[model samples]
Structure formats: structure tokens, C-alpha cells
Target chain A: MDKENRHHLWLTVPALLSIGLLFSAYGLFGWTSFYRATPGGLGVGGDFTFDNYLRIFGSWRELAVIGETLWISFALTMISLVIAVPMALVIARSPSRLVRSILLFTLAVTFLSGGVTRAYAWMVLLGNKGLINLALVHLGVIERPIRLVFNWLGVSISLVHFLLPFTVFTLVGAVKNLPLSVEEAARNLGATRMTTFFRVTLPLLSSGLVVAASLTYSLALSSFLFPLLLGGGRVRMVANHIYERLFVAYDIPFAAATSAVFLVLSFVVILGFAGLERLVRKVVVR
Target chain B: MNRRSLERPYGRLVPLTATLACLFLLLPVVFVVAFSFNDGAYFQWPPRGPTLRWYVNFFESERFMTATEHSLKVALIVTPACLVVGLPTAVAIARGRFAGRDLIATLLLSPLIVPGVVTGVALLALFTAVHGDLGLGRLLIGMFVFGLPFAVRTMVADLLGLDPRLEEAARNLGATRLRTFFLVTLPQLKSSMLAGAVFVFVEAIDNFSISVFLTDERSAVLPVVAYQYIRDFDDPTVAAMATLLIALSCALVFAIERLIGFERMMHINRK
Candidate 1:
């Protein structure tokens, strides 16, 4: 065989194998509703039906849970972005070795700690007998400990902490790669520093902003351990809710529908952003 | 040069804010370590007295040991599997110009965009649908799905930076495609492959979402076990476990840096 054919053969085997493995796995997981059982079975043995999708729409509780999950995820993403952007800007522009080292250490810790461990740390801090309560009691901030654990606030705080490093890292890349010569040229032409930043730096950095925001948004949306542990069942993100339906409720059909909704939502958002990016690129070129 | 005069003050302000941001990020992790040493069972700000009981308790506990073992086993298996799939995928994407390349790349990375909970649920469903029940095989498959994309992306970046002419030169010498890849391409790709492997291992070891959905008592991983301890019991044992895992991750990171150099690996990851 020719070299091209030989290479193709080698590539084809693994590529086909991966596709088959992944799709077959998807099939087995009831990813498609081709196989389903009625509501009476204790396990996964059932005939195929669209009952799961119907059940998801029919249940107000499930709908409400999903709505709440989206709200928290979006909120976390927005808040983290608000905090992370300036921080990224600082890290990019800073000249201090001490400052850089500190930032590096923070990234290391954030990346190393798993979602559940971070949640537990927050739980300790926010719980009645936790650190925050102890400080509050000492300071007389309140007569008794405030209820912080197993709440939306706690969940948000932990999720933001978890996602902060990623936001900074992505944004830093965007900001650092930006061409500074133009900004300097604008300054030489008598533009004020503020004007230069708002007019030049921000616009140039917008691509990075979009990338960081979309990434953070998707990450927060899919986060489960934080909401599960920190939210204390008070905060049920879509992912966790789907998990509960599958594991606790054993409602495979409904779980499948929930998964489908998640997949569609993410796909729509991603495609929308991709289109926006294309539009932005065209405008930039023009 | 003109911007320097005006930009100087703003640059000075950056150090202060960056320092503060770093503090905020490190606070929780520092707290975890501090609380682990607190004499009180509950997390107290000022330690009543420092003690090593939690660490000792963690080591003695059968559950923690089993979970640690399980986590290590999964990481060992999952990291290599991810590399096996990811390296080839990277090679194909980075070097080959083919139809549907973008789509294939997207498909490989779809797991990263999908929520971990969803991945876990999807994998659980997929496993049961195919095998009638979940087992180690399913759990490993789920971990592979999650880790593969990251490995592939990192390796692809690494491969893109490589000089393709070197491989072409080897091919000109009448080396077969397989021989060229193994002798000429593989050695050059080692650092990238190692970096990808370490990345996958860390991700796999720390993952709880899939483990939660798929793990049984016999196959329970460390994160799941640590999570259970934290949930059912309020104790420092979880903290002790976290400390161990943190140490393990740091050691791996250090080893990777020693092997490939930190800057090189970071560059690949950033790319």
C-alpha cells in the first residue's frame, strides 16, 4: 500500500473505534429514548417510550428546580467575571514579583482542590459552629449564628471561588497577547489614559472577555458538587437535579429528558456565541 | 513610550489589587489546612490546641485507605487510557487536513462543555443500557470521556508547535509511516504526552461527579469517600484526606516540572 493509504488505515481504525465506543455507550445509557420502561419497575428494564420527556414537562417541581439552577449558575458566572476581570487586568499589568508569586500560588491551590473539598471548607466557614459564626459571635454582629450553610449564598460563594482561577487564566492570556504599541501610539497622540483604556484596551480585550465569560458560564451551569454540598438541597442546579432523578427517583425517562434539555441549552448558547464571535471578527477586520 | 508616564500610576495600583485577589483565592485552602490541625472537632478560628489526631485517624480508617487505593487505581488506569486515545486524536487533528476535522475536534471536547453531573448521568445511563449494570469498566469509561478532551487539546497544541519537516525528512529516507511515527514523531512528542497524562491524572483523581454516579462500595474512589465523610459526619478526617490529596497533586506537579520544565508545560497548557 502507498504511504497515504497506510496512514489512513491506521487513523481509521482508532477513529471508527472511538465513534463506535462512544455512541454505543450513549445508546446503553438510554441517551436516546429508544428504550424505556413504565413507572413501576425498580430498575432500568422497561419498554421504550417518550414518557420521560413528558414527565419532565409535567412536573412543576422539576421545572422550578431547573429554573433555580440556571439562575444560580448565571449569577455565579456574572459575579465571578465582575471580580475576575479587574484581577486579570492587574495580574497582566503588574510588575511586582511578590504579587505574581501570590497570584501563582492562588491558581495552584484553586486548581488542586476538588469541588467537594472546597465546598466542605466553605461549609466549615459558614456553618453555625463554623468560623464566620465564631467571629460574628465575638464581634456581636448578631446575637446568634446566622444560617449560612445549605443555602444559595454559600453555594454561590464556593462556585465563584472554584471558577475564579480559570476566569483569570483565560483573561490573562487575552490581555497579555494584546498589542500594546497601538495603545502607546494613541497615548502619544494626546489621548488620556482613561480614554486609551476604554477606547483601545477594552475593545481589544473583548474577545478574551467573551471566551472567559462563556467558559465560566458553562462551568457554573454544569457544577454539581458545590450546589449539592453547599446548597444543602436548597440549591439544586440542573446537573444535580438530573442526577437525583436518575439515582434517587430512578426515573430514567425523565432523567433522559433532563439531559436532553441541558444538551440543547448548552448547544444553543455555544452556537450563539460562535456566531457572535464570527460577527465580531468581521467587524474587527472591517 | 509616551504612555509610560500616564500608565505608571495605574501599573502601581495593579500590584496592590493583584495581591488582594491572590489572598482571596488562597483563604479557603489555607483555612482547610489550619482547621485540620485545630484541636476542636468543629472548625474553630483560633485553635483550642493543635493536634495530629485527625491525620492519625485518617490513616487508621479502613474507609479512607480503601478510597485512596481506589482513587489511585482509577487515576493510573484512566490517565494511560486518555493518552492512548488523545495522542492519536491530537496527531490526526494537528497534522491531517481532512473533512469534518473541526467536528471531530468538537466531539472530542464535548465532555468538557457538558456538565460533570450530566456526563456522570449520561455515562450511567449509557453503561446500564449496554451492560445491564454499572461497574469499574463503566466508571473508567466515564473518566476517560471527561479526561480525553483535555488531553487531546493540550497534546494538539504541543503537536502544532512541532516542526513537521523533521517527520517528512524521516519519511523521505524510506521509513514506513508506523516507523516514522514511533521513531521520529513519538520521541519528540514525549513531553507533550507526559504533560497531557499528568493533566488527565489530576483531573481524574479529583473528579467526584462521575464517581458519585458510578461508584459502588467496592469501587468507591477517594473524592466520593471524602465527600461522604464530610456529609454524614462533621470531622477533620475529611480535611486530613484533602491534605493528603493536595500533597499527592503537588508531588505530581513537581515531578512533571522536573521532567519537562514548568514553563514548557505551562506554555502547552496555555496554548
Candidate 2:
């Protein structure tokens, strides 16, 4: 028993150490949020207070930043889902091998490139002299280049691209799990295809949809580059705000406070989705 | 004979939507590739000519080359470190069947769920709280945290698929536990290890958000440098660099796809 325990401990030590380091880091971060900023702007030094937290909530600007972050995150998740479900279904059920391989290759390229390159690609496409603008000019569709980059529109487009592959693959897994015979039986029994899809297929994908949504939401909320680069410093999300507070403003306490609120907000969103998924599971299973 | 429910446009709609979505995903990538050859400095349509100047410029620039070197160095180091740490934990998760196993798994995977910005800031704060400056060491730790969960998750999935009987049979024939794992089990895990290594390497190289916070003057990675360059200049050199990245990523994906197939390699959540 002793030897076995020792072996188990040895196997787990690296993972334990990594997680331990994270907990300690975040714990100190959470603790630092409570410390009042010293009068001099050098560092935090005062006794415990809720001033940092209050300041984050009390300011109208800060409140709007949080709201915008949540809104963008939610919008990206929903838009990606709307776009991905059909794509996933086709990928899973397509009869043509070429179509399947092409779709899979597209997804693999996007996923492997990760978010930074994807964002950069959007910049190239959406810039003033970019393809869209240039095409619009030659066709006389518009007299001037539309402001696509450095705004919510640019951020949303890039974010949706960044998010689509994950959702599609996830839904592919869910769609593959579904027994095709059930759908076939429903169609054979006089149910319209739309009705069969709505009553049967969509509900069965609830868990996958939930997981995808949560993933998309958190990524969007945590987005720094999108808003920083695409937002043109005009759009500020929670992550960007925290970064500014820490580095630009040099307000460590305020940044810590913002981080804390952001963490809580993410937890709330996740738990809310989990609850929604439970409700969905109950309705779908019955 | 009329087809059943020919009224429904299911065939047309599904393919149309899938094509559009794939186009949306690839449009930017195609843009990057094409624009790199544009003769103009800024993005322009109906190019005056096609030239390799920007690609040449990207290779010629000292700063860009240095950033690429740093990124390559960091990714090369982090990949093996992640696998070294993650592989054993993956085995334990797959085979232990012990108390707190689920909790351990959750904790290990928590970095995936946590916001990268939060993790970045938390690490920043932790380092500052200890009076340490942000540099290569902190950056590696932050990235290691980000990549470890992915490595472990992939390995765990691969490990769970193995039949225990193979190892058991080996053990029964007088092979020691360590010897069984090395001679029998490790070979089976090669594909997963490769997948996880590639993922970690790509992620570490492509990392911008967490590394953004940790970057000092001496430690700017390619993505960070590219971001700063784009912020200041709208040149096609960044486009050329981005094209290089797209090429590298495609090569990696193609290599892995040929090795183990794309879907199996990347479907980390596959049951």
C-alpha cells in the first residue's frame, strides 16, 4: 500500500505542482484586489477595503465596459452557433467525400492557425485598402471605404471566424452520436422533416450547443487582441480594461478588482448555462 | 416516382450553408496569402504588379527575424516540457480509478475554462507580489499552464482507448510495470503525443494574449511583434509574416493529418 501510494504520488506530482502554482497565483491576485492603493502611485500598501471593488462597480464607464464585454461574448456565441449547426450537420451527413474533406480541411486550417493569425487575416480583408473596400470601389458600390476595421463590426466578424470551427466540430460530434434511424422513423411516420428536426435533432444537440456556447463566450470575454487591435483602442472589454488598469494606468489594485469581477462574471455565465443545459436535457429527454 | 418530401430544400440549404461557412473561415487566410505577393506596401486591389519584395523584406528585417527566433525557441522548449509533465498525469487519470480522480482532472483542465486574461493578470500579479519582473521565465510558466491541460486531455483520451489486457499480459509474463509501460504502452501513445506536442507548440508560438502581459524588451515573440508592427505600420511585411505562419500551420496540420488523420488527432473531446 505504501509503495503504491508513493508511485501514485510520483505520477501526479507535476500536475499537482502546476495546479498548485495557479491556485497560489490567483489566490494572491484575489487577495491583492482587497488591498487599497497607496497614496503614492508606486504600489498597493494599505489595509483591506472594498474600495477597489466599489470603484469598479461605481464608475459608469467601468459598468459599461462590463456590459459591453458580456454583450459581445453572448452575440459571438449565438452567431457562431447559428452559423455552425448547419455546417456541422452537412459535414456529418454529406454523401460526397470531396465535400466532407474540404469542409474538414477548412476547419482544421482555421483551428490550427489559432486566434492571432485569424484576427490578422480579418485585418487584411477588412482594412481600408483591403479586398472588400477595393472591390466596392471598382464596382462603384460605395464612394468611400467603409470603416470595417477597429470597430465592433470588425471584432465581431473576426471573433465569429475564430469561434466557428470549434462549434462546428462539437456539433459534428453530437450529430454523429445521434442514431439516424430515429430521424428516419419520424420521417416515415408522417412527421414533416422540419418538425422532425425541431422536435428530435435540435433537442438532442442541447449538451453540445451548451458546451460550444460556454467555450465561445469565455473566449470572447477574455479577448484582448481583438478589441485592442480591431477596436482601435475605442472599444474596451473587461480584459482590455484590466490590462489598461494594470499597465497603462498603473493601478494594480483596480486591475486586480477588475480581474476578480471578471472571474465572477465568467462563473455566473457558466453556471447559468449549466442550469439552462439541465432544463434543456430534461425537456429533450422526455 | 416522386421522391419523398421533394418539397424540402434540405440538400440545397445544407451544402450552401456549409460552403458559405467554409468560405468565411478561409477568406482571410486566402487574403493573407494573396496579398503577400502584392507589389504595393499597403493593401491594394488590382495590384500594379506581383513581387516577392515583402517576403524578402520579412526575411531581411532584423527585428522580425529576432522575434521569430524567440518564438521558435520558446515553443520548442515548452512542447517537450508539457509532454514530460502531462503524459504521466494522463496515465494516472486514465488508469488510477482512485478517490479525487475527477477533482484532479478538473483542476488540471481548469486552465482551459478560465479566461486567459485572468490567468495572465493573476500570474502577473503573483510575480509582482513577489517583486519579480515579467520576462521569459514567467512567460514560459504562463504558457505551460495554458498548454498542459490540452496535452493531458489529448493523452488521457488516447490512453483510455488502450486495452489494459496488453499490459496485463506483459506483466504476467514477468515484465516489470515500468518495462511494460515503456515496451508496450508508450508505442501506442505516439500519435497522441505527436498531436499534443504539435498543438502545444502551435499554441505557444501563436500565443499573444498571455504573452502580451509578460513581454519585456528582451522577450518579444513573433505574434507580439507582428501586432505592434501592424499597429504602427499597415505594410504588407506583416502580411508576408502572417503568410509564413499560415504556411507553417498548414504544414503541421497536413503532416499530422497524414500521420493519424485530422479528425482523430484534433478531436480532443472525442469519447
Best by DockQ: 2
TM-scores for every predicted model = 0.90, 0.93
Q: TM-score, chain B only, every model?
A: 0.88, 0.91
Which residue runs does candidate 1 get wrong by more than 4 Å? Answer: A1-6, A28-49, A90-93, A96-98, A136-144, B1-13, B98-100, B132-135, B165-191, B261-263
For candidate 2, the share of real interface contacts preserved is 0.61
lDDT of 2 by residue, A33-143 (tens): 888666555377878899998987889988899999998889899999999988888777776778778898888888877666777778778888778888898899999
Q: Give the lowest summed-lDDT range of ten residues in model 1 chain A.
A: A1-10
- The residue-by-residue lDDT of candidate 1 on B1-271, one tens digit each, is 4535845635445556566667777777778888788887876555768889999999999988987887888889989887887777787777666667777776766667777776676666666555546456667777877787788888888788889899899999999889998999888877888877877887788888878878888888888888888778878888877777666656766676578765455455556
DockQ of 2: 0.58
DockQ of each two-chain model: 0.51, 0.58
